[model samples]
Target: MTDAPVRTDPSERMCPSTPKANATVFLGMITPAGRVAYVTPPLAAEVALAGLPDPTEATESRYRLAGPCVTSSCGFWTGDHCGLGERLVASYQETGVPDEAALPRCAIRRTCRWYAEQGPAACPACSHVVTDAR
Candidate 1:
């Protein structure tokens, strides 16, 4: 049998092709209240099954479910690495949260990486808990 590709940690895979900060985008899951709850790669199998919101149909009213985080807070963040966490923090800080009443349905519910990683639990900051809508 042929050998499978070497499996690298998420941090090592942060920038495979380029050394620039914007070379690649790291995925993260935030809350409806504009807080970064989790961060990981998009290709993660668990992410694909946790159910995320559709970017096309996503409205500003919807919670920012997945996106690139700035490098500072990213698990892979480093001086020589991309600034994904910094970018995410900037974006989140600039945008803030949307109106709670206008939040839209999550499209990636079955494939959300954060949900799969964290499971249904209360958010540490707001104490808001996540439940499977399905």
Candidate 2:
């Protein structure tokens, strides 16, 4: 089979917990509860440096750029599948977390790998993972 092209088109949406860099397009914020809160007029740069009236440091492990497409640069990818998504699903099952919850109102759900691979079941667990919640 032909290898999937390394996708780099900006995602229509992004996951908050995913590691992001300053150059990433700021589309949304992952609330403390793990729900994604989208920005109406997405910031062109990191929120911490957006020069807002009350700018706060983009805490090292807190917020990062998330978008609507898969990042081949991510270490979790294996061909067209996301290894992290698989592990997240398995972790949820091992923890006895029920996989029957309403899908989150995610801006990137349509293009999210976890959502695509694990379906609605991945949402509940997605909230629990952060770029640096440890």
Candidate 3:
């Protein structure tokens, strides 16, 4: 296998789908510790056969589910800049999350656009970013 890291678009990052069919890569469902884990195609097929329900859809919790990989053409993007990343950093600062001192050890860092644009400061609030959380 090539040693080069996978490069993902900011608009295309997504949580893994349950019964994660054909998912070769996954971001773990947790806090700053979440790491992108790789799954082989055969293993993904086996998981699909097990009839697992999507955790995020099945509950009214703040946590996320491992589901299909998807993308969001966020309104925040402007001329290669990420407004959402800026907002995330701002929110952390406003709430005293102490974002600047550290960043989560994320698996998607190499491929993440926000990390590329905003640097490590965006990771602390990254986990709390759920689609339509409002």
The better candidate by lDDT, 2 or 3, is 2
Per-candidate Cα lDDT values, in order, are: 0.32, 0.53, 0.44
Model 1: lowest-lDDT 10 consecutive positions: 122-131
- lDDT string for model 1 (1-134, tens) is 12222233343322221112232222233366654343332333223323445534322222223333344655545654444323433444434444544333332323333323332221221122221112
Candidate number with the higher lDDT (1 or 2): 2
TM-score of each: 0.24, 0.58, 0.48
- Residue by residue across 1-134, what tens digits does model 2's lDDT show? 12222224444434434544423444355577665455433454453336445445554244444544345765667877777777878888754544445454544555566777777667666756655523
Which runs of model 2 end up more than 4 angstroms from their true locations? 1-16, 22-56, 68-72, 94-101, 132-134
**lDDT winner among the candidates?**
2
Ranking by TM-score: 2, 3, 1
lDDT of 3 by residue, 62-121 (tens): 233333233344355565566676787778764444454455444455545566666666
Candidate 3 colliding pairs: 16-66, 16-67, 17-66, 17-67, 17-68
Candidate 1 wrongly placed segments (more than 4 Å) = 1-11, 15-27, 39-50, 53-55, 58-79, 83-134
* Runs in model 3 lying further than 4 Å from the true structure: 1-25, 30-73, 94-102
